[model samples]
Target: MSFASQAREEIARRSTVKACCVRAVCYGIACFAKYFDTKGLVLQTEQQHTAQYAQQMFACCGVEGTVVEKQRPSGILYEFSIREPEQVERMHALFGTTGNETSIQIDPALLRCRGCLSGYIGAAFLCSGTVTDPQKEYNLEFLTPRTNLARDFEALLAEHEFAPRRTRRRAVNVIYIKTSDQVEALLAFMGAEEAAAQIQRQKAVKSVRNRVNRHTNCETANLSKMAKANAQTLLAIRYLQQENALDSLPEPLRQAAAKRLEYPDLSLSALCGCFEPALSKSGLSNRMKKLEAAAAQLKQKREEACNEGDCTEQPAHRG
Candidate 1:
């Protein structure tokens, strides 16, 4: 089966899977109704809206009511009611949805101006700036979401040499364009290159935000190792030492290992929490061991010299 057919089937399967067997069968039956004429479906008055919608679309596009219908091998009925067969070619060139024509009803109350930058202003809202009507009507499903809508709209308006007034209604943004002709021009630009670019920019921004969020989430869980110090961290330690704890150790260690030695008793993993740009636990442990071993060797050498002097002085008298 075709991918779309399979997708539709999958959607149907999911919708029915959670219901009782009888309810599931009812869902399957509903799926089959898609092949028949919209009017033929047994539904409530409000639910019979599709039949009326299809008829309205047929009239708007100047198509006759008569059309061919068929039952498919998959048990779904397919119907075609284009006003003209050439309308199919025109639609494919225009909106890019292939095969059957569907009706889109836009409410003036819900529709917002797309501004001068877009070709879709008459048919759809640009969905940006401050809308005076908080309850403004627009095609919610057809356009991108409202986040950054004003910024996007302004950018598009700048591109088109139109200055749009930004206003807010009920916290929703609306871009006010002065003329209806501009709205028509905006509608005309729908599915055009400039509109596509605007939408593309929106998608790119969304992608960047998503990537940043994912990175932060991963770091919180996985960046547990003690990282090595950068120049800034080393500098911070140097400044801290000049103020206090001056007599704790020799000057060489104070400068070289000052920043990293803050949590001397901690294991590498524990030490990572004490600084910025943390190093791996193993790396921190190794550096600490090397410093400790050197200090131990120096102490041992001093003890050996003192013991030799004592032995040389006492042994001569005993003999």
Candidate 2:
């Protein structure tokens, strides 16, 4: 099952303070309902557990509502509507909704206790929130059609130090938390301990995988540098041999060149071990610099020889 489903199911199975539960269900209906006015009230969701929880909430509040189920292209939809004037009035009083504004505010009574606040946030999530797979990303967002309502929700989270961010996608406003710690904290606050643990496990796995990849890349880069250096040194030694300059070099330089030619794939430190008296990596590097310089001088001389030949072959001034 999806993480969102798991979280909602877990929350639905747990019990909370009666006042907290009433406020939570009220907030959910206000946020997710299709219509919430004196004329009628409608609360809809695709989650069966959420629907069942909503029914239980209404029952606890002594309000009667009709539950309807329908099949849609995406999934099953559960819609709960309270059309009776007396029940609708009771809901308005319970949620403290003004019923004429573009935004809904949390009832102050809901914030009087930490438990109530937790329930409010949890119910809001069950109605409109979605969490990305932790294996892919650390993101949990509540999608709401009303921008002002989303802003209000963001402020509510910020009031509790949740540090949510707000953005608009098409017509909906998204209030999201991106950090894994915050996502885990939110899940825990909502009574989904198992889901929070799952996020932590995924984070640990990702951390280890990233460390391994970085180590492998570092090794690959080092090997590539070693190979390129070895190829250049071999080319330089070959140039000296072709020019009949190898036998004329000091014994140490000649020995170094010979060893390099014999083991073209060895790293500088490894090649140092082949010397009679082991040379430090820096010492071997200095010798390589000398070989490169000698090869450079030879290349310059050949270029000069070619330019002179080209000049001599040209017809003497054609005045």
Candidate 3:
């Protein structure tokens, strides 16, 4: 039979059995109703407790986020990355305490994939834990074809606690454990709650590492480009300085040229290019040459002025 059909039949059988069993043991209908009401209240209380504990456990693992559902082809899954190496080690320690010999594998390789860890965790719960309530599930349809291991593990987990329910929506089944203390113990024993936080941290670290590497590479490339552009500009500026380019230039250009002359090897091209509307390389070259010619003329004029002054001041000399 198809899995859905089998599920339907199983559900029907269980319902009938439950109805009959309850009716047989009941002294009165009112008493049965009361019992069911109390059970529901207890279940709700446990769910709330579990949610709080899940939060605390996640916090203890140093994960400060809510548990999020991630969709996959085969089914929906819960996922968190380990950011702290210590949390990972703590998780490893939790799994180490379990004495049950199930095929629940937790290792460095498993750490990379949250789905894998979830599968193992679900399996471990199934093999050893009791399910007091039967409505919790982890959806299998979100998984890929033939990943029966995860699906089966989820089934076993549900069977141990409560009946699995199917919904039209494709999301990871959020099974609320009915027994809060048991859930806490399981978490403590398996180190799953902390491990969940650790997983979140690990993923965060990997993301950061990738970002840093990418930024570093980009910066390196940009720096190289800047250096090349600066080198060309500096070369032009030095040539102008050597040729005495400053005094011949217009006021603004002359000041810029003087500044370039002060650092003779500095790139005038870069300074010109940095302007709002960048100058063409040839424009920069022309401007520098003009400044050089002007500076040389000014220097010569100064020298002549000084000589004329000295000639005027000198006494008729010498015998």
Candidate 4:
């Protein structure tokens, strides 16, 4: 089953014994169902389990309904309709609706009982709510064709401290929550504890994976930069030695160069350990810079004096 279906099934199977909550559940089912009018009250779902649960709720409201099945391109649809003359009148009285209102809205009077909101919302969800898989994204929404009813639903969510946004899609009003925290919270609030926990677990796994990827990328970039820098330093050292300018460098510079030549692949930081006193990375870096500058100065001087004399060597390190 889809994740949303799992949540709906979870909601549908929960036990509610309180009279107020039971009435609220029936109201929620009526509010989001396909129709709730004098002719008949109808609730439909692709889930037979949910259809069965709705029939039970209809019975709780002093009404009787039968499940009707229909085949569609997607799957079989199970509809529970209360059309008997006596049952229809009881259904209307149970919900406090006359089928004459301007627009279908959640009656505040229905929620006068404490702890009834969650049961009501949960029932509404089994009818018109859907939640995406947490691994794919964090999204949960409730749909209704009536704009006023959508607004009322949005207000109800807000009163319970949930942050929701509303928009229209294909002539349907959508009340949605986009963040992980809210989505998880709503699922838990609606009594889908396992579904909510799964979302939490998926979120944690994704966070860890992203953090590890960033660290790995950062380390790779640093290694590439270090390799390029080591290559340039080694080139300068080899040219200085070829031109017979190594002996002119200071004793400390000579030591840094000698170690670098001995271990051509070692980075400056690693090379620090080869020294007797274990030079700091910054100290080794400075020495390497001076050596490169000295070599560059020598090369420039030789180029300028090449035509004047056989100036192929230097006795003093160039500044």
TM-score leader: 4
What TM-score, over all chains together, does every model reach? Answer: 0.24, 0.66, 0.30, 0.80
Where is model 2 more than 4 Å wrong at Cα? Answer: 14-27, 35-41, 57-68, 72-74, 81-104, 132-140, 143-151, 163-188, 192-228, 243-254, 275-279, 286-319
Report how far off residue 30 is in candidate 3 (Å).
Answer: 37
Better of 1 and 4 by lDDT: 4
- Once model 3 is optimally superposed onto the true structure by TM-score, how far is the C-alpha of residue 117 displaced, in angstroms? 14
Give the backbone clash total of model 4. 0
Ranking, lDDT, top scorer first? 4, 2, 3, 1
Residue by residue across 1-319, what tens digits does model 1's lDDT show? 4222222222222211121222222211222222212232221111122233333333333333333344556553334333344643442332233424242221122222332112223112311111111113211111222325445544555466655555666665555554433432332343223333433455577689999999998875554432333333344444445434334656544433664545444444766555456666666555555455555554566578778874222454554
RMSD of each: 19.0, 6.6, 20.9, 4.9
In model 1, state the lDDT of residue 218.
85
Q: What is the lDDT of candidate 3?
A: 0.39
Which portions of model 3 miss their true places by more than 4 Å? 1-191, 258-319
* Local error of candidate 1 at residue 317 (angstroms): 29
lDDT of 4 at 245: 94
lDDT of 4 by residue, 1-319 (tens): 8999999888888888887888898888888999887687788889898889988977876789889999999999999888888888888888777766778889888886645898888988998989998878899999999899899999999999899999999999999999999999999998898999999898899899999999999999998999999999999999999988999999999999999999988878889999998999999999999999998998888888876787655668767
Model 4: pairs clashing at backbone N, Cα or C within 3 Å: none
**Clashes per model (N, Cα, C within 3 A):** 29, 0, 33, 0
Candidate 4 lDDT for residue 3: 97
Q: Write the per-residue lDDT of candidate 3 for residues 228-311, one digit (tens) a residue.
A: 755554565555556555344467566555455455444555666564577666776676566545555655766797788853
